[model samples]
Target: MKNLKMKAARAGKDLSQQQLADLCGVSRQTISAIEKGDYNPTVSLCIRICKVLGKSLDELFWPEE
Candidate 1:
């Protein structure tokens, strides 16, 4: 899995992990795990993230092809 470009993009928007986590209804650790490629989030989680980031799921997560 790719390390999260999501975090980078969020940072570009000046959003902190805690802020993003709150917006996404998840923990900071969950955001950290996602950023580190340490967790494969559920589809629902992915959708939440994408929605929060104003991105589509495909823009955030690509399969390991």
Candidate 2:
């Protein structure tokens, strides 16, 4: 359940975890936890992250087939 997609997308946007977290009103550790697959974000947080990264939920957070 490692969230490589989220990590890659964040890198593609040239954003640090702290920057994304700031944008989404979350803490850096929260972003780190998500990227590390140690935490599951709420839907609202997912949408905020997607918006900042210009990604859809499917692109950033959905499980791959």
Best-matching candidate per lDDT: 2
lDDT string, candidate 1, 1-65, tens digits: 54557877788778999999999999999998999889999999999988888888877887545
Cα lDDT for residue 39, model 1?
92
Q: Would you give me the overall lDDT of model 1?
A: 0.86
Worst 10 residues of 1 by lDDT: 1-10
Q: In terms of TM-score, which candidate is strongest?
A: 2
Clashes of each: 0, 0
Put down candidate 2 lDDT per residue, 1-65, tens digits, no spaces. Answer: 78999999999999999999999999999999999999999999999999999999999998999
Which residue pairs of candidate 2 clash?
none
Worst 10 residues of 2 by lDDT: 55-64
* TM value for model 2: 0.97
Candidate 1 Cα misplacement greater than 4 A, ranges: none
